[model samples]
Target: MEKPLILVTNDDGITAPGIRALIKVMNKLGTVCVVAPDSPQSGMGHAITVNDTLYCDAVVVDKDAPQKEYRCSGTPVDCVKLAVNEILGRKPDLCVSGINHGSNSSINVLYSGTMSAAVEAGTQGIPSIGFSLLDYSLEADFEPVLEHVEILAKQCLEHGLPTGVVLNVNFPKVSKEGIKGIKVCRQADAHWVERFDKRVNPLGREYYWLSGDFVNNDKGEDTDEWALANDYISVVPVQFDMTAYQALNQLNNWNFSQ
Candidate 1:
């Protein structure tokens, strides 16, 4: 039996420690081909490069396993498209993104480049999972979640995911023992209220630096935010379709005749 072909990617650049850790884990599971951004593309949403020309270079990051890595001058979603269309030339058995430097739980999923990569793979009908550790440091340790990530990856390979769906997995930023078991949950209702700090430049010109507080309004215990807060890894099944199907009839009943 052939080893499963896995396409691994991330928003935190291909050379980041997070991606390196993910690549190491993925190599153990299958024939891993990494196609990630040349630089960090975090919080880029599902952006694509259209006007600019895209560049993909084969890199020999690992001396022993040459030709297994690629750096793309594109967004995370673009990396998936380029990997599927240009690099692999065939659909992979599984697609995994991130082991991200920070969490993508709750509303973060809407802005996460990591999740976008996984969603892009799911859109292509590939089983995909986006893993994130709730640590934001450049050198954040991923040793704790590695086993969990491997387990989830293997599970996805074994059971396979539903169509048009991808798993958003987030781990707590603690030791393996400090972390509780995984919990399948829904995305928490949350939003970041932007509060730009006004500042002055050296030339006395005004400027603004983006800042915000993460406001989690959902009090439900079954949400991803709640699970993470309780030291449990959260797994939320996410979809690309953002349609409010239930609101269709509600909109139809609204007074639009003027």
Candidate 2:
């Protein structure tokens, strides 16, 4: 039996503790190759560099680490594109993104660079997963979720995922024992209530800083938001297709003969 080839990436920069922790766990699984952003690209959603030049440089962030690593000067999605097209000689068995610094649950996935990378891999028929923790702190402890990460990755490699689907896994801020269990749930109907704080610099120019509160409107117990709130790790299977199948028939019934 041969060791599986795994590709690891994240929206957080290559040197971030979150990605470094992910790399440590992946090394135990198989041959690992990392191509992540050189700087944090938190909210870049599936963005690819078109007009600008992209750079991917092989670098050694940790001497003891076994994985071949590259720091990409582009979005998380761009990293995946480059890794698949240029870096890796063969297709990877699995692709894992994140172990991100903060949550990408509910509607946050729409803007998350973490999930976008996984989604990009999923688009290419790869078994992919995006992992996130609720903690926003740079020094947040990732030790608790590492075991679960390994378990999920192993399962993904063993069973494989459905076509056009990727897993979005979010961990609540809890101790290892504090976790109730894992829950496969649907994405919550939630969105940000945004507000901008207007301020002036010393040059007398006004600027606005974007800020928002996350609000969950859905009361469904089967939602990812509910699972996380109840101390469970939430796994939501997300698909790349944006079509609304239910609306197709309704649109067909409309009068267009004129």
Candidate 3:
């Protein structure tokens, strides 16, 4: 039996420590091929570089590493499209994205480049998973989450994902022993309350720094936020379809004619 062709990507750029950690674990699973952004595309939600010349270059980061790698000057979604359409030339057996430097739990999934890559793969009928740690530091330790990532990736490869589904895995920032375990959960209801910090530059010009606090309003025990709070690696099965089918008939009866 041939080794599964595994497509790996991340929003944190190919050189980011998070992707390096992801690559290490993926190498154990199968033949890994990476097509990730040339630079960080952290909050780029399913964006594609359409109006510009997109390019991909073969790069050797870790000369000792076994898998072939390429850096793409595009968004996370673009990387997936390029990989499937141009690089791989055939759909990969599995696609795993991230080991991201920050949490992509709850509503954050909507804006995450990490999850976008996996979502792109899922849209193409490929089994996919996105991994993230709660820590956002560039030097955050990932040793503890490696085993969990391996387990989830292997399970996805073996059992396969349901059509139109992708896994979103988020780990709490803690040690290996501190992690309780894994929980299959739903996305928690959350929102970011944006705030702009007004500041003055050296030239006395005022500027605003983008800032926000994540507010989780969901109290459901089965939510990803709850799982993370309890020190568990939360795995939420996500889909791209955003239709509110239940409200379709309700909206049709609204007083639009009046």
Q: lDDT winner among the candidates?
A: 2
Q: Name the weakest run of 10 consecutive residues (lDDT summed) in model 3.
A: 45-54
C-alpha lDDT of candidate 2 relative to the true structure: 0.96
The TM-score, computed over Cα atoms with residue i paired to residue i, of candidate 2 is 0.98
Return the TM-score for each candidate structure: 0.97, 0.98, 0.97
The true-structure Cα RMSD of candidate 2 reads 1.0
Off by over 4 Å in 2: 256-258
Q: Tell me how far the alpha carbon of residue 15 in candidate 3 is from the true structure, in angstroms, after superposition.
A: 0.8
1-258 per-residue lDDT for model 3 (tens digits): 899999999999999999999999999999999999999999998888889988899899999999999999999999999999999989999999998999999999999999999999999999999999999999999999999899999999899988889999999998999999999999999999999999999999999999999999899999999999999999999998989999999999999977
lDDT head-to-head 2 vs 3, winner: 2
Model 2 — which ten-residue stretch has the worst lDDT? 82-91
- Backbone clashes in candidate 3 total 0
Instruction: Write one digit per residue (lDDT tens) for candidate 2, span 1-258.
Output: 999999999998898899999999999999999999999999999899999999999999899878999999999999999999899977799999989999999998999999999999999988999999999999999999999999999999999999899999999999999999999999999999999999999999999999989999899999999999999999999999999999999999999999
Candidate 1 per-residue C-alpha lDDT over 105-196 given as tens digits, one digit per residue, 9 for 90 to 100? 99999999999999999999999999999999998999988999999999999999998899999998888899889999999999999999
lDDT by candidate, in order shown: 0.94, 0.96, 0.95
